[model samples]
Target: MRVSRLSVVVAAVVSAVVVVVGSEGAAVAGAGGAAAGGGGHEVDLAFHGDVTLRAGVVRVRFVPRNHGPSDLADATVRLRWSLPLVGVRRLPVGCLRSGGGGVLCRTGALEAGSLGEPVEIAARVAGRPAEVRVRIGTEWSGGAVDRNPRNNEQSVLALDTGDVYYF
Candidate 1:
């Protein structure tokens, strides 16, 4: 059977409409899946270091914040010093040696959009070592996804017994 010109035109228009509608539906479905996967569980970390220097001594308070839609559990913090500071001690977080003048501590659950309790670390200047620098960051935990990993680490110059701070 020979097809008429009008019938051919109608068929082409209907085909085009079906293809466009199908594509839109697929796009919507994919967006819905992504939203469900996120589930307000995206977590991000931000680090803040407070350094105190006085009389050949240094103290660092490492505060990490969870900028998240949900709370985080068992997050870890790491602190590293440039100098081989003597008399180093970690209070309350049970941090252990991480080699090369570094310490690590595990935090309890961090509330959503909250700053964690500061981890206190102090050390004595070892016979006029080089300028003190402290670097602090968060360690990854299982099943928790951090949306912004770049802000998880921070470094600061210790403000104690140095030309920068004291005379």
Candidate 2:
């Protein structure tokens, strides 16, 4: 009886160990299977810093990240500035390449003929739009100019043709 009980105890302990090990292996296998299946990749889009207007030129930067599974393509950025009576003008869209760090975009003069203070600025990825109010000014402090009076600076801006993003 004693020998039988000892054998039973040993068998029970071994069975428990085998079950635990088997379950852990199965869990790992399940995780691997899930990973093998198609999972959507996550991408992060960040603005490097605030938009700066100096000497009539507007400088903007964007940072895009491909978390993995896929790469971002055909990314386009549109800049719009609000004018008093003339309405909103769609500035040329610039194509940016992803460097080791991020994507960068710089805009030409706020105005073609002269530098006009911009009331608002926006960035769009693909066809989506994200806009922000921008403080436009020159290096020389003539005075604070309010370009957007009615606060209707929120405007839909478009990019010029032939401008697009490449992964």
Candidate 3:
């Protein structure tokens, strides 16, 4: 059998395409030999916080940390409470009220291996419940891809006994 150069090149191209397609969701290393997403900079933001509910009032204190090799221009964090909000007493500088039981906050440009500004929010929930479930997650990360999302999302159950519950 005789082989042509054009045929060989075409075969190689098809093989490359197939390989790339097959590894779509697989853990493949990037161009720089790092196991990031699509060879782009990875930004991982982990949130640590504590919440206390007392006398129908809820207080939250949290800090975000970047654990990746890249810096993000900005990031958004979302907090949701199980009960509806009756009133907002205080919110961080870049934080805003969202809906009835949610708050969204923006963390200005965060560098890798650095901690963002501490956030504090105080609000009142409608009626009095024995406990409230608070969920924290990353809303946005400057369009960067995060490989590990488990650390960025957290959930906590805070009782009205005024004890701080850490997430």
Of the pair 1 and 3, which is ahead by lDDT? 3
Per-candidate Cα RMSD to the true structure, in Å, reads 10.8, 20.3, 7.2
- Per-residue lDDT for 1-167 in model 2, tens only? 25688898999999999999999977655554425442222222212223533322233433322222233232223333332112212433453333221232332222212222222233333222232223222121112122322221122222332232211
23 Cα displacement, candidate 1 (Å): 20
Model 1 Cα RMSD, Å? 10.8
- Model 2 Cα shift for residue 38 (angstroms): 9.7
Q: What tens digits encode model 1's per-residue C-alpha lDDT throughout 51-141?
A: 7667666777667788876677767778777766577754565577677577788767777789877677777756654457777777655
Quote each prediction's TM-score: 0.64, 0.24, 0.78
Candidate 3 backbone collisions, by pair:
none
- Candidate 1's error at 34, in angstroms? 10
The residue ranges of model 3 lying beyond 4 angstroms of the native Cα positions read: 1-40
Candidate 2 residue spans exceeding 4 A from truth: 1-42, 67-69, 83-167
Model 3 poorest 10 in a row by lDDT = 25-34
Clashing pairs in 1: 53-160
TM-score for candidate 3, please give it.
0.78
Q: Go through the candidates in order and give the clash count of each.
A: 1, 0, 0
